[model samples]
Target: MSKQPIYLAFSTQKGGAGKTALTVLVASYLHYVKGYDVAVIDCDYPQHSIAEMRDRDLKLALEDDHYKRMAYEQFTRLDKKAYPVIESSTEKAIDDADRITEQADFDIVFFDLPGTVNNPSVIKALTNMDYIFAPISADRLVLESTLRYMVVINDVIKKTGVTTIKGTYMVWNMVDGREKSELYGVYEQVIAELGFEVVKTFIPNSLRFRRELTETHKGVFRSTLFPPERSQLKGSNIDALADEILELIKLNGNG
Candidate 1:
């Protein structure tokens, strides 16, 4: 039987919207926590943040003992399983994806697409995906770009009969629940009116995410320097979001 891998395409026509960050987080969680053999396709050519982050983390793991220890401890608490293997590929064609899928032996393949709808290669890649996750922040410009991308995806689905596009979702990244942000209500209303699914979990704006990049060579962070309280809480939140995403996948019969 042919191996059917779960294809997740992360795209938004808006950069600096946490697309790469969330892609790495989800790929890490699935590999470390769920024990899935995952591979990341870096479709975003110029700024391959996902690939860069993975490379930095790997180098730190090899050179810094303290960082390695910290990373091991964190992974232990999160999954106690094998660490996810992340790699970079700049394949811009459907045939290229098929070749990668055949050779990588991955159960889940994620495409880190560029933040634009005009790329023909990206559109070709999206055609082969089982899930298209568009992360949108509570910003006017970002929202406008994301909505335009969604419209393009809708048209593609209509033309190609690929139901895998599922729907566009607004992930409340860098969100502060305490304050009443005007864009939050407006975006939520717009999403609902357009019949899109809004993920229940929100990724709050915190320094912890930025700190995840600064661990020692051993993947260990200095507990005294950066207390574990916030990291632990953020880890829990990420775990919840992963679960919610999995639920969405299952609901669409893709998981």
Candidate 2:
């Protein structure tokens, strides 16, 4: 029997912080590379980006020789099928995740939630998650928005002792070498003072993050069906992020 699925979300009230991309990339890494049974509940309705990506991935794998061969070789090597990405509304996301997990033994179920907390269902869905990874960028507006959002999540909901959330983490995204390291340190210190822990792995800015598996592309970096190419993962810090998340999960007795 598999353990109860650990619910997680890469969330923040701020848009353009790479929540969907991180959700897909990290879920793929954990499922395909780290030998975990994973699924995703795409509750970002109207957009349903991850579910749409899955659709595009299927098409690409069918019509594109490069993707088809890559998919075939990867599936054969891993002896595992692609993880499920369920499109659902925020109100039904938890129930939908339960139904899917009941059908298959999944170690983790990642949720791609809406970018705003104004909706009651969004708050409900977030409260049910076992872990929340909020992405923050170096920009002033982004940081301020993330901080205010985290205050609601950390102080208002989680601290009230009414949620399943075990740990809420802040992840630094879009980190660039051109930026001063001190800027990050100062932000980290502020976040720490607010009693939030930031993940040690900082995801560097890279064009590969925006790339997808296409007919002409030689390597696949992000897909619902396959793990990213090792070369594409180079300098992305995804592996380290996965490791740190797993470590935190283990520490919380959920891994």
Candidate 3:
């Protein structure tokens, strides 16, 4: 039997909350490292960040000997093509994803949706997701905005029982190592009061998280075509994050 493709997004209503970053990393991790069939629907229209990155990655891999050789070795070993990134709008995202699956079966199709829920089409797409992982930070404004967003998603969308959404989780991103433990404890209590679960793996704040395919950088930390090199990923907690997401999906009986 063909398994149903899981639809997921790393989302929050707050801008600069690391939604797009997490989407690319986790999608790459699942596709390259874990050997899952993955595809990305870049629905953050006008930007199409992931799609653009894919283009940049391809160009760099062609021009730079370091990246070119790495790509060659990876493709030779894995014998799998880089997962496709489809440029789409929020209104047509679900339809585009459905069409992609019909062409090539994917284990998961990640959507990089816009950071606002004001539009009905965006809400409609959210309702179609099997899971949504909202990345939160230690900042006061980020926390407040994220909590508010989760309330709407939980009370308005998931509770309707008319949607495919199984869970909406909180993932701690860009965490400062020097922050007091008490602060996070209080935040956790608030999150629990709001009735949302957080992913166990907290991503530490690091410059490596911001690294992209660049002309000067010899090592790749983030790419749409390949997983972050193991050395670059050392302290990011992304591998653990991906594993936890899969476990949660399985617990929900979708894996």
Candidate 4:
């Protein structure tokens, strides 16, 4: 059996790295696909992107005929309710998440944090995570920022000794397969030397990333109803990445 109420965060010190997107992707898979009880805490106080996405997903689940039917078909056999969406102050999101896990029958709690470490509140929130999975790109600035962010928080953990953070791992996001970049090779080397383990499953940059909810948005969630083989072609390697993450968590005894 899997562990109960594992708290995870998808964060980075740099913005526009698909933090919100991946949070919802894995949340959707865990709840709708793998049939686990899940909750999401949108801690981006200003943006509330995760909260908006959750509302969008709920609307689709309630209003779209085909989507509602698919959701019911998947959820009918389970005892869990529809996933909950929470909006919290950046300063209190971690404590709020702990309360949610303690009070709810959730298997996991996913936190969507803002893309900066300048705030003292955010640093405290980072120490609350049982695991932190950051999305990284080929950009030098982003790589540097994320590495620094990890080291800073790890130091906090060492100093405070008040966290379940086994370690932080980076996921390769927004890769363009048609063209190979020398920058990525260099980034990989530096990331390895920095002791950051980049996962093997890399997500390709795709149009499906932008589309959402309605027929027009064309977001990747629409494809979740498709068969597994078809969803694989839709350019979100999220499920594969989720599997790798689950294995790592279990092996680390955080599961």
Candidate 5:
């Protein structure tokens, strides 16, 4: 039987839309909670953000005894062996992905794509993915770029006949709930008109995210790390968001 792997691509034609952050969160969640043997392909050449984060996490893990123990425990529970993120692009990255799927025995592969649509390598990477998650902010430029990315991917799907595009998801990241922003409403309407599925969960603009990056810990987002000064995202909200994403994968049965 062929091993079916979940291929998720975090993509957009705009930078600074929390692509890398979302990628890390998803992979970390899968590795720690879902117990998936995950591999990451850092296809964002010239600036491999995913690779950097992984390296940082590794270094932190090595220095911190508690983190090391946690990582070791997670690996022991995984059905498949652990593999590090592969950093490559162009012909080489494509070749590596094929090899990794065949040999490494991963259950899922996350591709951290660059924020530009024109790169041939990026298009090739997208063609291989089961789903594309496009993170969008309330900024006009980012919204325009996200739409452009969707169009580009749609074109590629039509051309390559890769039916795994599934659909595009617009996640509201770095949102502030206290303030009402007109740009948020405008972007939502635009996305609705464009026929994209907007994810209901909004990742609040919190310092916890930055702390996660520095601490290099997994599942911090899963728990309420602090009170008052660091308000945790509602448990129901996180659970619903996770369920929606998982349901997308289950419904398609492609990822």
Candidate 6:
């Protein structure tokens, strides 16, 4: 771990942009695959998708053999322990994230924020983030919303005056191979000008990503159902994404 109590969030003003899915992906990777302490705050207000997903996962993990074996293998790889993931609202997520880190000795905390910034509570929650990642598709509407969201996060950085976000990254999701259209390059150029990074490890356009994940609560990518190593996702895949994230933490210097 670069430093303790690191806080990062997955956010975008657009719904269904893979915030919760990627949140689980990264958190599970850190905890099970890399053997670091991690937790997640599902602060998506009305939806609380993370919490609901956890419940569904528990159901299937108990009933399904593959999920049960996956959980068993993860614990066996580690020391037979579980990481903590809590659901909180904006008003309490910041404090709770810190409290859990301190008390539980968590290396990183992930926040799965709501899809809209219209809520003031949600806006306030960004002040606690040390880094923020936004997953975006190649669609025009999503790009527009993502651009507006980046501006809002930049504004929050200035307004807070406390280095709320050390870096902002846009994750290219559902990408149709590296052979993107001209539109994709243009968006990357614009985002680079805004001082944000486009993560190199892109998730390929695959129904595997769209697979209903309730059956594998221990993880989606790390689970045996969709092994990252053999899957057609990308190099390092989620594992590489996790490594890049750790490198990012080194760049942030205790953020």
- Score residue 225 of candidate 6 by CA lDDT: 24
Which of 4 and 6 is the better model by lDDT? 4
Q: In every candidate, how many clashes are there?
A: 11, 0, 0, 5, 0, 1
Q: Candidate 4 — what's its lDDT?
A: 0.74
Model 5: which ten-residue window has the lowest total lDDT?
222-231
Report the C-alpha lDDT of model 4 over 140-229, residue by residue, as the tens digit: 787788888778776756457877787688988988884447877788888888777888888888766665667443334532232232
RMSD per model, one decimal: 4.8, 1.9, 2.0, 3.4, 4.6, 3.7
| Pairwise lDDT winner, candidates 2 and 4 | 2
* Residue pairs clashing, model 3: none
Model 2 ranges with Cα > 4 A deviation: 178-180, 251-255
Give lDDT: candidate 2, residue 249. Answer: 78
Q: Which wins on TM-score, candidate 3 or candidate 5? A: 3
Candidate 3 regions exceeding 4 Å error are 178-180, 251-255
Tens-digit lDDT string for candidate 6 (191-248):
7887778887676666555444553343255332223434433543666777788887
The TM-score obtained by model 3 is 0.95
Better structure of 3 and 4 per lDDT: 3
Question: Can you write out model 5's per-residue Cα lDDT over 109-144, one digit (the tens) per residue?
Answer: 778777766676666667777888888777777777
Q: Estimate every model's Cα lDDT from 0 to 1.
A: 0.64, 0.89, 0.89, 0.74, 0.65, 0.72
Q: Is candidate 2 or candidate 5 better by lDDT?
A: 2
Q: Give lDDT tens digits, candidate 2, residues 1-255.
A: 356888999999898999999999999998898888899999898999999999999998899888788889989999989999999999999999999988888888999999888889998998999999999999999999999999999887888888999989999998988343988999888999988899888898888898888767856788899888899988888888988998887732343
lDDT of 5: 0.65
Task: After superposing candidate 6 on the true structure, give the runs of residues whose Cα lies further than 4 Å from its correct spot.
Answer: 1-3, 159-163, 212-236, 251-255
Count: clashes, candidate 3: 0
The order by descending lDDT is: 2, 3, 4, 6, 5, 1
TM-score for each prediction? 0.78, 0.95, 0.95, 0.85, 0.80, 0.84
Pairing residues by index, what is the TM-score of model 4? 0.85
